[model samples]
Target: MSYAEHFSLKNIPYGIASTQDRPAAVATRLHDLIFFLSDLNLDSPATLNALASIDKDELVKLRRTLQTALGDEKNVSRFGIPVGEATMHLPIEVKGFTDFSCSTEHLLNAGEAVLGVRSFPPASLHLPIGYTGRSSSIVVSGTPITRPYGQYRDGEEIGFGPSRAVDYELEMGAIIGKPSTFGDRVSVNDADEHIFGVVIVNDWSARDIQGFEMQPLGPMNGKSFGTSISPWVVTLEALEPFATEPPAKKTPVKAYLQDNKIKSSYSITLNAEVLSEGSATEVCKAQLQWMYWTFRSLVAQQTINGCNVNTGDILGTGTVSGVGDDEHGCLLEMTKGGKVEWELSTGKKRRYLEDGDGVRLTAYAGDGVGFGECTGVISAAKPF
Candidate 1:
């Protein structure tokens, strides 16, 4: 009955796993063992998305079944699938992925440097701003992030090359489990019924590439390179103990987003590090409390437009930055867009990541680690 808080008997989070000879199957973790859902007569599960599309009642029933099976001493051996022999795959099949801007601190800090403005557009004050990200580019943790190449504006001269400013953004993604029909809307209070869990996301960015192409609409090649995510999906019900009120809103949102009265945040603590040239540097630590738009509210806003949300759709909370310099979420904010070199504990300093720099991020809530580390090392860009 005992396991880490992240994946305990009470928290049977789902994911996809496989051994060399076995096909991909749905699974839940209690400790070292991965309880394969297929063995429970939930056979041949290709992915968690199949279960995600089921009704809320069914989802609850399955969760409870896993919880009960793991709790019973007699059922333990049968459910204990060897986790060491398995490989964890992406938890869900992301049919649609949306990246939302939720941290005012990020906008404020990044805007000044990237856009030469003190604030984001006025639209940010009213509704959640998001862009459809490349679903195909979303890779699991441990994947390498190849530096992207695109046309860059070099003082009015257009040049195509690899980005000089590569950065990592610390964020949490809400995994949508329940399906909603087109034109259906959800309130902030009911959003949880649709959200299966949370996962750590590292939305890698290439400043030079993003900067040049983001003007006409939103990001393009700069963002499509690669985004990394942790393997486990920690259910919200398990995180209920960590729930806390969001910060006092400095800017008010619209009607649908305010249904919860601003109590929709979690107390998860997030941190990022860089392993470069044999030196590991602790970059920043931030909490989800600093997020301007809570996950529930973000869901309400997304569906408010009458857009149908699929079972595996992921709503990403953009860079969760806090108030202090030590709490910045991305290197752009911490270094002021590469204008300042941040000192590392190893006596080295960096303005941006160089080749071979491995970026790893982790989040925690109490003693247990949040969604395992979402890691990606930088590789030199492909040839132009």
Candidate 2:
């Protein structure tokens, strides 16, 4: 079958592939055949930055050219490589990463249960709250996450050791395709144009470490260890069919944040599942639309201050917790700060992840088409 008929023509996801001799090749796939973009002279850079560096019109042209080539039988014999022969790498060259906390229920639940607070900061209402994260640690899916060690509050005393509360944050990661110079700002109305695509993010967290260091500042060692992202880049243009109008803001945003054109938030269904002891149980099944703030809102807020953003920078949509327990996005929220225990389908119980456990996150835009799953297996930390 050709790209249009079998691979879902609507989704022309991109990724980096490599063979034993060649460490990298930018390519697109349709079933077992991988089409190297270089064959068509459409892509040359080792990273997606080449695609991002170009303007929207150029992007459309490159995609269109590739689409036509993939549909032609003669082109396949020249550009295609067997999928089994190549290895996948991180899809983009990540220069920076920022994680935004945008779920109302997450903030409220975590604040009350973890910190015993009752109200949110006034600024949180006016802006989307977020913090910079360690971009060097972001890895492709299938990477193993070694549990991290950090200073944690143990009972009445503080101690440093391997974290006991290892967790995974289910999120959608937006990739910045357009670079903005330092001091340049993108308004809410134009934010969508700057976004290239999205990938599923597994922001691994050590609850004990995060909880201890979060007060003085935002996450540090608690979150710096490792983050896994799905290799496929699902373009925003493909999601037009599933876009939804976000709920009316309780408090309207500032003038720059207003954009009637920014009408729909992609309605992607997100799922987080844990596989342990040969058993699998889904922990979170929610939708991206449930987030209190949408991507346009988050991106605009991030650039409100004169911050230069580069192509390949990853921005995460905090945890996508919905209203119910089943809709919760992480163990910290589902267990209510580890106050409860969750039993798996195999009858195994968990307060947090154990070594050898596999955590996977999957997402779909409409009905059942998906961007694939991002997953990581827990491993013991190196000896102290």
Candidate 3:
């Protein structure tokens, strides 16, 4: 579906983090509001208990005085604390985020483009594939991302340095609320009950660093550097109307991963835009929709190994790329390993991202449930 028809300003996504100006705030497009649970000066313990049970709305408003102070730019004096004081750090206490590799088109394209293979790994066809990523690196959108430094090897020998190939992966992420134990494997039918909401995730990549290290095992430091996510978490209940079937499987799947009652995916439009330093032009626009596996399958398969998952654990959908020329997820694929060039609207060309380039990834469910935006700007690598 077209973007304008589906997304709107009222539907802000939620995220948990400490901003530079306000150490802990509920980020929305209009402004960030500081939430102080301990200092509300409740009439009684029951009032505080009642506040805790009132949901995110009541909790946001109980602290409106803080909001007023923040709005008037007098928060430091009003609270008798530092201007950006945060009594507590943001944690997974509210929601758990997870990444899933459900996009078959992206997996296939990336394999062919990066590994010179035309098909998916046989293991992926039968089950949803995923890996655990660092939740600590997950930052609120609009945060400045520092380029990660790691080891690299272009010619069989490993050496340490700042990454030469940094890229962005366009994907959706899910928030987990209900937890499960190590011995419990949720059936596909019951997966949605464990989910709380969804958010846009920019799983930043250091392709060159990853290429050198990702053999024998999967991504490590290459993927651990940082992950950018939208602040607002859009609830699953809000997205119920947009459920749709995922692309048909080219190969057969195991019974445990299939769900007759639930459709596997949503027909959401995903796009990525890059802004280079000193340029007013939008560098790229990539759409998302051609995924192989659905979010439900990923959740079901995650527990197959008897691994327990908690409320805030994140599962990232790997980069969602399509078959068209403008749909590639990263520059590595768009430029075909830098063997081709991408023409921007400004008439300039790019093979890969340069320092100071800002990348933004956005997505929304077809029925108007917007997941908001995930964005990060690349800074120059620390001087060697």
Give each model a TM-score.
Answer: 0.93, 0.93, 0.77
lDDT of 2 by residue, 113-208 (tens): 687784776677677789998999999998999989899999999989889999999999889998887998888888878888888998999999
Which candidate number would show the highest TM-score if scored against the true structure?
Answer: 2
Q: Report the number of clashing residue pairs per model.
A: 0, 0, 22
Candidates, ranked, TM-score:
2, 1, 3
Give the C-alpha lDDT of model 3: 0.63
Name the runs in model 3 displaced over 4 angstroms.
1-98, 155-159, 278-289, 366-368
**Candidate 2 lDDT (Cα, whole model)?**
0.82
Q: What 10-residue stretch in candidate 1 is worst by lDDT? A: 1-10
Shift in Å, residue 112, candidate 1 = 1.6
Worst 10 residues of 3 by lDDT: 44-53
